[model samples]
Target: MKKMEDNTLVFIVDVKVNKHQIKQAVKKLYDIGVTKVNNLIRTDGEQKGYVQLTMMLWMLPMKLGSSKLSPIG
Candidate 1:
């Protein structure tokens, strides 16, 4: 996950899973408190017959504050 200058959280995920599983995972994140979840892009995986997904999310300050430091620095 990455934090933008305006405080929006960005997540680029690549998962070798099906669409249903991806929806379930995103829903679970929302259920657990992730806000403004968005599916940025979805594409087939490099490997044959697999899938990949990309998501962008905006996180609450309280949530970001409690998390570990970002690795970007």
Candidate 2:
């Protein structure tokens, strides 16, 4: 977690989503004003050999207001 100028803490989160949903997820983040996405990796799922996306995301502080947000639109 990194501290911001406002003395609030931010967390770096690793998320995995179905490959087909990557675009939607990233777009949703952008809409919420979060653009600090880190390393993005693609891998195969263990069970059905489906493509999966692993990306590093930034978690904003609670003071930002929208806590329960969904990246899928």
Candidate 3:
């Protein structure tokens, strides 16, 4: 994991890594639950199958939209 501006972080992961794997790894390693995940696949001449994973972890759920804060909205 690389440090980004402010407190954000960036990670370069393999394309084979699934969403569940990412969630487990982030939770196990950082003890934080990711609020959202953005995945972009980049397949060029170099790599057969490559993807960029972007995970946004919420420090506090209160900052999110009111609707998102509720379990059933």
Candidate 4:
């Protein structure tokens, strides 16, 4: 639960999903290259995946009723 200085994204994934699946999914969905994958099972019975990306994404949250994301300039 600590702050990550690296370009890491935390995702709550299914228990059956493996590291390879997570890596591929991230690439396909977000177009971000993953450098590494770390998995941890939380006490609440959920799997948290720490995805370290190859590049930093300067993207902010979508606006109200927006269909796409906008990167900060």
Candidate 5:
């Protein structure tokens, strides 16, 4: 994970996940507003998604340490 700016967060997710799907998932799961989603393909064949949230202060007190896959709209 990377912190690009005050309001942006970077995540490495499954390549099959799309930008819109990511935006929805982040919004629903975190209860935070997402302004945008950008994708970056790495040389080693990994997908990086940089999410622009409305505010970084809305992050939960606990860290998102696990990559659990659940049903997300």
Candidate 6:
């Protein structure tokens, strides 16, 4: 399974993964609603793209489980 840090709405994702796919993935994985998703493609970089999501729709249990994620430096 993929691990994500708390306080982060952005994720480095696959080049082929589109907005719809990402939305579906997040929903399926977290079982929460998504308001919007912003994607930025970066070429010739170690990471392909950055995906931003809103935290407006979140599940209490899911958020609780994510507490272990350390803050990004």
CA lDDT of each prediction against the hidden true structure:
0.41, 0.34, 0.43, 0.72, 0.72, 0.55
4 against 6, candidate with superior TM-score: 4
Stretch of 10 with least lDDT, candidate 2: 46-55
Worst 10-residue lDDT window for candidate 6 reads 1-10
Cα TM-score per model = 0.30, 0.21, 0.44, 0.72, 0.70, 0.59
Off by over 4 Å in 5: 57-73
Point out where model 3 deviates above 4 Å: 1-8, 44-73
Q: Write the per-residue lDDT of candidate 3 for residues 11-72, one digit (tens) a residue.
A: 55677876567656756665554554444455642212121224332332433433353222
Worst ten in a row by lDDT for model 4: 57-66
Cα deviation at 62, candidate 5, in Å, is 9.1
What is the per-residue lDDT of model 6 for residues 1-73, given as tens digits with 9 covering 90 to 100?
1213432256678777888887788778766656656677776652332333355323334565764544344
Clashes of 2: 0
Model 6 residue 35 lDDT? 64
Quick one: best TM-score, which candidate? 4
Worst 10 residues of 5 by lDDT: 64-73
Candidate 1 per-residue C-alpha lDDT over 1-73 given as tens digits, one digit per residue, 9 for 90 to 100: 3444433434455545444554466456644323334444445533221112233233432444654545352
TM accuracy, model 4 = 0.72
Error of 3 at 38 (Å): 1.5
46, model 5: CA deviation in Å?
A: 1.0
lDDT of 5: 0.72
**In model 6, where do residues sit more than 4 Å from their true spots?**
1-8, 45-66
For every candidate in turn, the CA RMSD to the true structure comes to 7.5, 10.6, 11.7, 5.8, 7.2, 5.1
* Runs of candidate 1 exceeding 4 Å displacement: 15-32, 42-68, 71-73
Candidate 2 residue lDDT tens string, 1-73? 3323332223222445443354355446543333333333336422221112232323432433566643321
Q: By the lDDT metric, which is better: model 1 or model 3? A: 3
In Å, residue 18's CA in model 5 sits off its true spot by 1.0
